[model samples]
Target: MGGLLLVAITGIALVVGISVGIGDLPIPLATTFSAVTNRMGWTAIELNRIHETVIWDYRLSRALVAVFCGAGLALSGAILQSLLRNPLAEPYVLGISAGASTGTVAVVILGLGAGTISLSAGAFAGAFAAFCFVALLSNGARGGPDRTILAGVAASQLFNAATSYIVTTAGNAQQARDVMFWLLGSFGGVRWPEFALVSVVVGFGLIACLLHARMLDAFAFGDETAASLGINVGRAKLALFALTAMMTATIVSMVGTIGFVGLVVPHAARFLVGPLHVRLLPACAFTGAIFMVLADIASRALIPQQVLPIGVVTALVGVPFFCLILYRYQRVS
Candidate 1:
């Protein structure tokens, strides 16, 4: 586990460097290193102001935000899949993202807060609302995994419909344009503050999930088995749900809803490292961080002089993988 974490961190450093170096400006890897070291006061070497400004003010924050968003979403997915015993479970699929989008739209478009409530707060509130709906529909902790999954599907549709009604009927043209763009996802507008929020939220999420790793393993065999093992199945399920919701909401609010990271990354990580949440959780975070960074790079490079949406890039990769998973599951059953 120690060696795996070291490799993962090293990989993150290398990939984040590559991300900073690429772009319209195309700074060299050496220059990127100097800019970072100089900023940290490790070296006092002079560098071009433009390079420094771009790296510190813009690209660095964006890359870091991508890292946390990916990790948070993947961690949430892993937790959900284990607890629900559903391979297809994820925040987006479970209506958390849709609920967050609705909440954020209410705040931004309808001015729900009267200029006080921040978008992130609204998104979190909205995500919590979705969780409530799912819980109510599924009968809370008593619902079996299949029942909970069905509830999630219903909640997703309900929130999605609400979001569309608000955007089409309530928001003006400019707000509509902005909301549409945001729905697709972008790291373009994110800066240091956004990175700070995501990092703190995702950090707490990873730690919390790790501490509950043994409980999660018990959950995989079903709630009754977990209860037999003295795991408070109901309480544990609710706690895990809330944790996943908070993490998902924060990421959605910061970067818009980037899908597939949660759905795809957890499964990939689980495959590379066997089940057993202690090891699987870290593998998920690291793999997710790497995947999102690569996807961010692809979003920029795919269409020269024009950036594609991050969600689109992920979907392109995730859709085929999704089909493969479905096929395997079908064959297994």
Candidate 2:
């Protein structure tokens, strides 16, 4: 546990430093530290203002957003898999990201909540709406893991179609392009405010998951087993589902729909450690954070002149793993 924590902390710091150095302006490592410490009042080191702005204002925030989003999504995936007893389960599998994108697009195009509410709030509402709809749909006699997955698929399709329609009909060419970039995922314009919200939400979600780790483990065996252990199977499942949805919605609001971090990171963590949620949870968060920060850096560094959507980079990395998981599932079934 201590070793893993050390690695996670060091990995985040190292990636943030490397990402800060990789941008167009190219700040040095020492200047990066000096800028950070100077801001924190821990050092009086003098640094160039332009470099400081680039590091503090742009690169650092972007990296931190990636860290928070990655951590949240991956942790959400871990919880959902345990709750559903489905290894293929993920944050996107329940349509949370699709719903969030739809809500954000509505705010961006239809002028919904133009005066008061921010786009993130709208996105969270949209995600919550979708989650409730799924739960309701899956509440009948046919409700089970398979039924829930089908319900989620239906919800996802519905939300995705709505998002596409809004983007096409309501937005102009430039606006449409921007919306697509967001739907596909981009950390391009992340600032401190977005990072702060994401950090707080992800932190809260992680702590909650940690507190309920044992219940989650019981869930892996199904509702009956969990109930036998004095766990309120129904209530616990709903709580976890809501928490995961909130985490996903918060991240999707900030970084757009970053796919595959949730789907892939938990599996990788399981392979590294084991299936215990107590160990698996932190492992997933750390691995996901590292994966996302690296993916964000790759999104810029892969093309010398152009920045690719983060979704593309993660997809390129995750597709093979997705295929392998599918193959294994087929074999097992």
Candidate 3:
């Protein structure tokens, strides 16, 4: 029943996204569908150039990007929360987003590199670095979820300070504006190749997390119980951590640090479906994808002739949702 519900929500989200894109122009639904069919070479119907550009080039790419980003972040959050046994655990909670932002900012401000090695590469490097630092700090000792969360908080603050300093010292208004936009996240420059890369990475991560769902459940009872069950807790944690970091890095590179989807979506899934990782993981993924698609549609259509940064739209939507979740959790407790 939960799976069916998730599928229904995702289907509705897709329809709404398509409608929003079509409504952006004077194009009717039939015309929009015809344009899409023409692009897919499914029919002899002809579409005007305006319909083609709006439907094929801009809206489709933006909507697909939102789906991927939302799924990736939500899945990442579910894994991290399970591994750390902390409700607040998320990709951004550990400074991965901040680190990625720092790397992207450096690339934009300094003109430091070229081609694929520029912004995306830099963001990946920074995210990996932050992951390693947090892992090192959390290793050994009685490092539970609380310790991990603390380590992530420290790392995130440090990275944010560095990124701020770099932006301010550059002192170029244009560069600052560029940095600001990237920091806030946008789906403006999404292309087929970029989407393909993100899809591959996110797919692998989702598989890894699902395969280890039992192990994650075991860990929820603590490391000793997992070890007693013949699960190598240490090895499992390391592998899951690496997978999450890689997936998060790929997304941060593409989207520039959208937040709260991971934090908010997983909790909402948990509220509806309970905390079995096997069920929760997939639920979170679908819910996240739907949430992000709606957010992206609003971002594009909320203002005419001006595209709002997707991250801003997500934060605006997510923060209030998050607060509501907290209140509900508190009431239950």
Candidate 4:
């Protein structure tokens, strides 16, 4: 397990550095290291000023945000799967992503809040609204996971219809184009602020989830079993659901919706580290960070002079894994 962790960490570090080094104006791997060391005051090495600025000001922050986003989403998925006892559940299963789209559309297409509300803020508000709606429909803390998921499905359909109506009737070509790009996900505009916010959310969220690892294990046997085992089923589900929502909302607001990391990484990590959340959670985090960074890298590098959506890259990888899981499921059935 320790060796596996070391490998995951090393893989993350390596890809992160590579992400920093590859771009329109490529920097050497050595220069990327030099920039890091120099900034950290570990070395007084002279470097090209342009390289230093790009490395520090833009790419590094984007990569770090991707790291946190990936970890947060993956951690959220693990929690959802455990709490709901549904292997197919993921971060966006609660309609958070659809709510975010509606929020972005309201801001960008419908011209709500004018200049007062940033896209991220609007999206967060919309996401929270969706969560509240779900809670209400499902009877909040008293609701079962199955009920909550059903509420989420209804919410998703509603928000998605709203978003479609607005886009078709209101937004112009340029506005629609912008919203479409954002919906598919990008790390292009994310910088230090995004990195800082996501790191704090995901970092503390991971710690909180880790503390509840045992309860999550109890949850796997269903709510009644969990209740019989002295776990506060309602409270635990509510707390874990909120945590998952917050993490997912933050990431979606910052980078749009990057799918499949949450869906794919937790399953892959579980395969490697087993179902014990104590070890599985950290494994998911590390694998997610690596997978997202590498996806970001692939997004940039896959097409010459043009970047593909990060979601596309992730889906390319995730779809096969998804199919394999389904195949195994059918075989078991």
Q: Positional deviation of 298 in candidate 4, in angstroms?
A: 0.8
The candidate with the higher TM-score, 1 or 2, is 1
Over 4 Å off, model 4? 1-5, 107-121, 128-157
lDDT, model 2, position 168: 94
Model 2 segments beyond 4 Å from truth?
Answer: 136-150
Candidate 2: lDDT of 93? 72
Q: Which candidate is the best by lDDT?
A: 1
CA lDDT, every model vs. true structure: 0.89, 0.86, 0.78, 0.83
State how far residue 171 of model 1 sits from its true place (Å): 1.6
Cα lDDT of candidate 2 equals 0.86
- Superposition-based RMSD of candidate 1 using all C-alpha atoms, in angstroms: 1.6
Candidate 3 TM-score versus the reference: 0.86
Model 3 superposed RMSD (Cα): 3.1
Predicted candidate 2 versus true structure: per-residue lDDT over 155-184, tens digit per residue: 899999999999899999999988888888
lDDT of 1 by residue, 82-189 (tens): 987878778887788989989999998889989899888899999999988987898955786567878988988998899888999999988888888888889999
Arranged by TM-score with the best first, the candidates are 1, 2, 4, 3
Residue ranges of candidate 3 with Cα displaced over 4 Å: 1-26, 111-118, 136-144, 324-333
